[model samples]
Target: MKRTIFQSIREYKKQSILAPVFVVLEVLMEVLIPLQMAKIIDVGMAGDGNLPYIIKMGIILVVMAMLALIFGAVAGRLAAQAGAGFAKNLRHDIFYKIQDFSFHNIDHFSTSGLVTRMTTDITNVQMAYMMTIRLMARAPIMIILSLIMTLTINAQIALILLITIPILGGILIFIAKKAHPHFIKVFDEYDVLNNSVQENVNASRVVKAYVREDYEIEKFHGISKVVFNLFTKAEKIVAWNSPVMQFTMYAVVLLMVLIGGKSIIFQTMETGELTSVIVYALQILMSLMMVSFVFVMIMIAEASADRIKEVLNEVPEMQNQPNAQKTVKNGDIDFDHVDFSYAGEGGNLSLKDVNLHIKSGQTIGIIGGTGSAKSTLVQLVPRLYDVTKGSVKVGGVDVREYDLEALRDQVSMVLQKNVLFTGTIYDNIRWGDENASNEEVQRVCKLAQADGFVQEFPRGYQTKIVQGGNNVSGGQKQRLCIARALLKKPKILILDDSTSAVDTKTDALIRKAFREEIPNTTKIIIAQRISSIEDADQIIVMDDGKINGIGTSEELLKTNEIYREVYLSQVKGGEDDEK
Candidate 1:
């Protein structure tokens, strides 16, 4: 346990050593002050009382106490500063590591588990480090120093003190070991409770729409109940330690008084000496009690440290290779006999034998049924999840060979679910291009058909958006996301059913703006609506992760049954509009 504690402290090397060194000095002052009081009483007040000597010892005690207080304060400040700094660095490291995790690694821990590790788990370790340095380090020093002083005063009474120390130590050690596993259980349940609450909060709208409020409340209560039970068990184990230590101290003090009285009567110890021995005995027991308290803290910290280590030790699935080369061109994409599956199961492919190529100035549309793997196929282009088989090349180079950042920068995707941060309209739009001028942002907003509503807001471009853009309509949020993506002027732009919420008129305006303003960029539009992709230069029809047909809309309508069926079902008045 001591080695583990020291190893943990080494993470804050200089601060840890300095804080404890000051604390040990303060403990020395504490032990010396009591001895000085015994001297002032026994020697200064003995025979013809030495007034000058008593005054000198009194002054010395006061000065020592003052110094101890100053050192205590300094140690406390240093411990807190060190604890906070360690926690800050730990959180930053964990957060940055989490960012490097690919979809596979992230899914293993879940969102709320990672959040719990970053906040609650780190806090436990920080509190432990602070308390260990501020209080625990002094416990042993004070106990040992007080015992030495007690033994020097009288060995007989100190013998009784020796017996109680082992008994109390044994009890504390037992309780600490018993409570350690429970503390771990408590934190695990805490993760479950956090996950439950977070899930309900993020999906509150869906819960309300389904009218499952009571059901959700029941589920939350169930999770909270488990956490409460675990906490109660841990508290019970910890609560037992204090009373048991106090009992042991009381027993030792009673025995010491009896033995010291015998010594006084036998003339083997003076009255003042007896007084000093008893005081030192009490100090020893009190210091042991403080040490026991530190032991309990150790148990809790051990549990939390294990939790923190779990996150810190996690190996991220996606990391840059040593000195990987980056792609150099603007926008050219090719999928060569690509096969992929979310399951990564043997011989199971989400996309199979797929080959496609798009040049820098081409517009392509992708259409498929609900389970046709349309989104998965495009996601591979951005390397969100790498393909299980074959190669996806961007700019005539394999994407895996390109620097991750450089590859992602060349492609911009507006997913079906548009996510918005809590910020002003201008700030959200600027996410695409951090250094974009106000005119550039405004231009994209106009292009995405978002300028009119944005201008009408009370603060116009500066209007604040709630998280998820909850304050705005769905169409408005989609348009804003589109504007953000457009602002990047990406080499390859992907719209994965992003314009579904907007009315046809707005959609047409956005399409017109895209054609006129950014005709040189390669575009991939994945849509379920026939009208949405009817005018593309090429349309690919997908079925069961395989490309079933690829041709212009007119050619597909005449020759492809699947494409014709989709067109007939969506076109109002059917065959007449199709013709």
Candidate 2:
């Protein structure tokens, strides 16, 4: 896991390495300052007031201080650079990995979970990385060097630290062990908190229409309170750090003063030597305290690191076969004895033993009630989800054998709940074919019956679409999405209930344009309204994860009970409307 997360520190290796080097230099300067002070006090102050020697030592001290400040500043800047750069690369890798994930892989993670991992989890890792490079490096070095200085000046007094150090170390270990579990629980709750905010924001309109704002607020507060309690528990455990550090520091200082004063009185230690030993003792204790602080951060970051590694270690379930086919030859689709389950093998099936064949350039319409697996069937053509058993073939080759990008480029799918990004209408349509010319874009919009209403806007194609295209009517959003798909000019176009919002007249015109203009394109339409698919060359009726009937509309009207019942009921309803 550590190896996986640290792999994102690609270009920042130099900064990461150099930051610690400067930290060493800074610690050296700080350690040397106390030794110099001992000299200034002994040789200068006590040696009959040697004025010139005192001035020389004072100047040297100032130089050391300035150098220490310079080294510390450079180390801080480099650490910041390394941390921020590492975060950017990590986020890039995570996002690209998500793009490669199949729908099956994506189902294992929630949208808000991914968001928290990329944003909050990565931020925590970044801070820990910076501390590891800077303070972590400084603390240990300072402790070792300070301990050496103290032992050199007075070994008997230094033994106090050895005793106090372990006592403090044991306390810290206990705090760390107890606090870590709470931190893990805290970050997991962060996922729930973020998910709550995301769902409420996305469904703001529905909540308002139903007048459920108070309910949403109460639910949000419930989630927030859980997060708050978890974080409080973790922090309360960590709060033991400061008091423990203070007591250890004071105890060490008291022991040093008493022992050193007795030694000085017996003439075994000079005043200057006693002062330097005290300074070194303080440095050692301070370094230990800094170590404890870094330890706490690592404990928190350990949980975050695991979350990040979860994403980085995930292997995309779908990938191109070796020596994969690069180009799709045609739109011919063949589903051979296909059986699929959302759960892995040996689970309840969503699509069961479905066998069907679609010729290139044929217009196929599928009508099914909810839970009929209509969308699931077309998703297989683009290799969105691989079949659990048997094979799905496109252009006479198994879909798994084709390069994922190449196959998806030729198969354009406009879903029932299609999405539009916040951009101009031109920008949204150009997502289909980025290199398409202005004339080509306008032509597809015309075919989709979107150009007329689009032109009615003051800015025509340049009009800005708000988030989710909320400013537009439902039919307008659907037509604009159709225009975007038409711009792809793909070999196979799948419309999964995409035209339900448009009126019958507009829908018929769009289909008429498809017949006249793009007759070679294979079109598949999934719709609830029978009128939408009555004129189709071949219509499929699906029921309970199986194909109940497959024929032209007229043939199905006579032979298929489900199709006949639906057709007569719709026809009667139309006559009643006329009355």
Candidate 3:
């Protein structure tokens, strides 16, 4: 985990190292200042009537103080740069890893949970990092140097600190252990709160439609209360450090004043030396307090580190072989005795023993009930999920044997959920082919039956779409998504209910355009309405994860019971509605 996280410090390594170096210089100057004060008090002020000696000490003291301020400023600047850079690289790493994750990997992490890890968790780690480079480096060095200076002044007084240091250290360690679990639980609750906010905002229309605004408010308040309670518990554990340090610090100071006062009265220790000792005692205790604060921050960041490492360490479930095939010559797809379980080999299968083949340019239609695994079958051609047994071959090559990008590039899929980003219509459509010419974009939009309405808008294809295309009608969004897929000019195009929102007339026109203009592109249309696939070269009927029937529309209507029942229900219903 440490190795994975620290690797993100790539270009920031020098800054990370140098920040602490400056901190060391600053600590050295601070330690020397106390000693210089002692010298000025004991010799220049008390023993010497020489003005030059006092003036020299005063100048030296000013220079050291200035150097300390300069070092501290440089250290702070470097620490900020290093910390921000580390966070930037870490966010990049985690986001890239998430992009490579398969559906199975994504299933293990909630959207809100991943969002928290990338944001809140990384912010915590960044704060800890800045503190580590600045205060963390200075504290230990300051403590050790101050202790040595105190010992030089008087060992008996210093021994009192030695005993107090161990007791304070024990108290901090105990608080840290108790506080850590609460912090971890607090971050988990944070994920829940973010999830609630995200879900509510995305579904605000639905909430208001059903008049459930009050219910959503109550739910959000409950999650917020959970977060508040967890944080309060964690902070309660951490709050012990301040009082513990103050009590121990004052205890040591009181003892030093008693012992050193007696020694001064007996003429055994100078008043200047006793003054320096008190200053050193405060410095040492302040350093310990800084360490305690750093410790608490570290305890919090430890959980964030684990969450980040989980994303970095997750291996993609499927990978191409080394020196893999890079070309897909055609759209011919063959599913040979394929068996699949989303849960891996041991889990219950979602697709079982599915065998089918399609020629390079043939149009195939798939129809099935809600749980018949229709989408599962089409997803395999793009290598979205590997079959648990047997093989799904595209272009006569096993998907795993080909480079993932090269294979996916040849297959354009319009998923069941048609999505449009917040951009001009042209920009969204051009996602299918980044360098598509204006003429080509217009041609595809016409073929998808989207050109007419798009042109009706004032700015035509340049009109901006709201997020998720909510500003547009559902049928319009579907047509635009279909146009986007058509722009790909891919070897195979799979539309998984992409035309469901469009009216029957528009859907028929889009399919007619496909048959006429892109006849050579293999089309796999997954549809709920029989009319959508009725004209395909062949149709597949799936039931309970297996093929129930495969034939032309007329043949299936005559010979297949399931197909016959669905066809009569749809066809007669249409005629009855006409009457």
Writing each residue's lDDT as its tens digit, candidate 3 over 1-579 gives: 267898999999999999999999999999999888878887888854557887999899999999999999999999999999999999999999998888888888999999999999999999898899899899889888988988988999989988887788888989988989989998889889999999998898999999999999999999999888888998898999899888888888899999999999998888889988999899988888888888888889999899888889999886778999899989999999999999999999989999999998888999989999999999999988889999999989988899988988889999998899999998999998999988899999999999999999999989999887888998999999989999988899999989999999999999999999998899999999999999999999999899999999999988899999999899999899999
The local lDDT score (0 to 100) that residue 568 gets in candidate 2 is: 85
In model 3, state the lDDT of residue 116.
Answer: 97
After superposing all C-alphas onto the true structure, candidate 1 shows an RMSD in angstroms of: 2.6
Poorly placed runs, candidate 1 (over 4 Å) = 1-12, 345-348, 572-579
lDDT of candidate 2 over 67-122, digit per residue (tens): 99999999999999999999999999999999999888888899999999999889
The number of clashing residue pairs in each candidate reads 0, 0, 0
CA lDDT of each candidate?
A: 0.83, 0.91, 0.91
TM-score of each: 0.94, 0.98, 0.98
lDDT of 1 at 134: 70
Off by over 4 Å in 3: 47-50
Which numbered prediction scores highest in lDDT against the true structure? 3
Off by over 4 Å in 2: none
Please report how far candidate 1 places residue 459 from its true position, in Å.
Answer: 0.4
